[model samples]
Target: MKDIQSLPPGPKPHPFFGNLLEFQRDQLKFVERMQRTYGDMVTMHAGPRPFVLLFRPEYVRYLLTEHPRDFMATQSAGGDLMEVLGESLLTIEGEAHRQQRRLVQPAFHKKRVESYADYMVQYTQEMLDTWHEGEVVDIAQAMQQLTLRIVVRSLFALELLDQIDEMGRNFSQMIEHRRSLLARLLNIYVDLPFTLYGKRMSAKRRIDAFIYKLIRERKAEGQDHGDVLSMLLATQDEEHPLSEQQIRDHVITFMAAGHETTANALNWTFYLLAQNPEPREKLLQELQTVLAGRTPTLNDLPNLPYTEWVINESMRVYPPVWAMGRKSLVPFEMGGYHFPEGMTFLFSQWVIHHHPDLWQDPNTFRPERWNPENDEKVQPWSYFPFGGGPRICIGMPFAQLEAKLLLATIMQRYTPRLIPGFPVVPKPRVTLRLKHGLRMKVERTATVVKDSVTMI
Candidate 1:
């Protein structure tokens, strides 16, 4: 082991708390301040538990890809999340993670995910139908609900679509409670009314009951529903079949993972487009030309490079998964520095996305940087919005398709204009989101063809 005092330079510790209070106050701003003050790397503590912050792309790549096993994904909540989520991909590790990834990989394959294109377009349209033209809408809230419905319909089919309202309310209460002080202490084990832990368990029970009911119905029907549920249930011929608990865990995990990230991605994409007029116009032009006043489908993606660019750049600017860290299992050396074992070492997408050296004019929303002609100029791990390495998000293909189609569908008919004087800031909890919901004024346009349908 190396000397603790020899670690990289960082902001002065605040006696007992170190940087914990500052970190808990506003992590994004703290990270930016650290980056400016300490350059590429910093060593600080969260109440005496010191961690390293690697803001450079080179360091991030080594930690995530080259020597991934040297670090473990979860630092503090490994046991906690596993208790709630089971041995699902997010919780599992080593060979177990590999096997689960293999089992779930096929469902998200490009060709397989494209089959759900019609569902994406249809569900998005259903959402837009509820919005009155020129109404002030909270785009963030709207996208969350829209993506939630899409997750249900696309992954499990329409059997549960009608129950979305009740489910959403229940889920909201549960998630909000999960963030409370009492719930964090209980950590998913405790149950019963008067406490936060109890409320969370109740929420989980409601959610679990709903999930188990879906599983029972799917198994009863015994017919393929052409969704994720059907795929998971079709393991009859396999030597190793998923247990009831395993299936339930996976369904709940996907429900939590799939919709939330995509919702934020869509939310930030619209926010970026609204703030930057030139790219917004460019995206609109590309949509009009390629889509020809029709809703977009997965097949039409290649022709809409600018649309893809916009989403990519938007994620680069405001990544949904803003930061992630791993606990160092063993000591390591790189760039003439030591990473002590048993300490948490973390990196932020926000830090890398805006790194001065890695990105030119990193603050600007320049979709053109993603153009093929300039592709080689970017280094790996510099713009990882959905994570990287073996544990990269399994739903990447599905999410990209969903975002593009949703963008084309909505932009084809209306442009969501941000309401003036509404302060926009990110609340980077679990996922990066608007501090106050994104308020937008929806203005309908004649760009869409009323009879148009997405071409298969």
Candidate 2:
């Protein structure tokens, strides 16, 4: 407990605002500099609140796995997120999280996810079919649309592919506008009302309404559709089934988390591949040898090692859910840090993944580093794209399979090239997407067909 006083070290903050201004401009830069100067753990003041940044993988492991109950996800300032997320598993802790996880687990089972492979392939191919050779659009936007439709089909069982562009735009505005820099910077000021945010609040309400309507109609029908909604309904405990509110919360949570994260991962995947052709060519060669231009399946994924590594490495470089915010529930001393209950602790995958000590040539886009022989060199909590411990991404397997399948299918039929000098900056909104879209040109690959011997 005595070590808590020295809990990492950092440059003293400036007067009243502390490090808040500098942290807001670029949180990643602040973190890297702290690690460079302060070593593992560093303390910084966010307004009046003191935040301890744990940079070492070992300590991050302790926070997430070894001492999970000791920490909690810090409260959001506005308090709207709780209403939006409801008592869903993502927000809950202890017994509540355990119960919700049990109810939600079966829906994303390996067999359930494997069954979804066809829908993913169909959707990816459909999008690729529409792309005209030599034409360019924001490849990131294209990936978002593709992944959104896949989520719609897999999770909602809603045939809304044609309507996606309209719905997706509105949903995007709602997410971005609500979390605007102004809102974040001004969060410390308590005078403003929730409605002051204007249209974003309205958009969020509408999204909630739309999801509730779907839940109502599904309930009225009362038949299993073999999708996530159906699975949630089918699951129940001794006293009662999930309430209407519970259903809405889970649906909205899934859409927000499931849709956005996967899209960004795909966007980064394509961007990295476009920039590095050697790996792309190698991936294509593997596809050719393994499936011979046919769509990939679960059975085929294990053999497509390079393709899998490409996606894995892309996630390493730009993890969609960049940081985990935890507040200590009880006084506990950590590696050379003091014990203080209620202190907010941040564990950033953004920092951990690129920690120079953990990764070789940390900034380079190299996929081979994840190969079997090199994976051992990686450390715990240092490279968690889908998090770790008991509360790991339930859809981890499902997400991985969907991503690899989509990549294989698209790479087989078309070679997408990044438009020269396209602004590929990451906008760390709800997920890491391009502040400006990732533009790319696609060239169709010739399909090879071989005839069986029928000579008389």
Clash count of each predicted structure: 0, 2
What does candidate 2's lDDT look like per residue over 277-379, in tens digits? 7887787778877988677877888798998899989999998877777788998877745668878877777788998888899888899998888655777
TM-scores for all candidates: the values are 0.91, 0.91
Native-referenced Cα lDDT, model 2:
0.76
Runs of candidate 2 with Cα error greater than 4 angstroms are 1-5, 75-80, 179-196, 374-376, 446-456
Worst 10 residues of 1 by lDDT: 75-84
How much does candidate 1 score in TM-score?
0.91
Write the residue-wise lDDT of candidate 1 on 246-316 in tens digits. 78887887887787788888889888888998898888878877877778877798899998899999999
lDDT of 2 at 67: 85
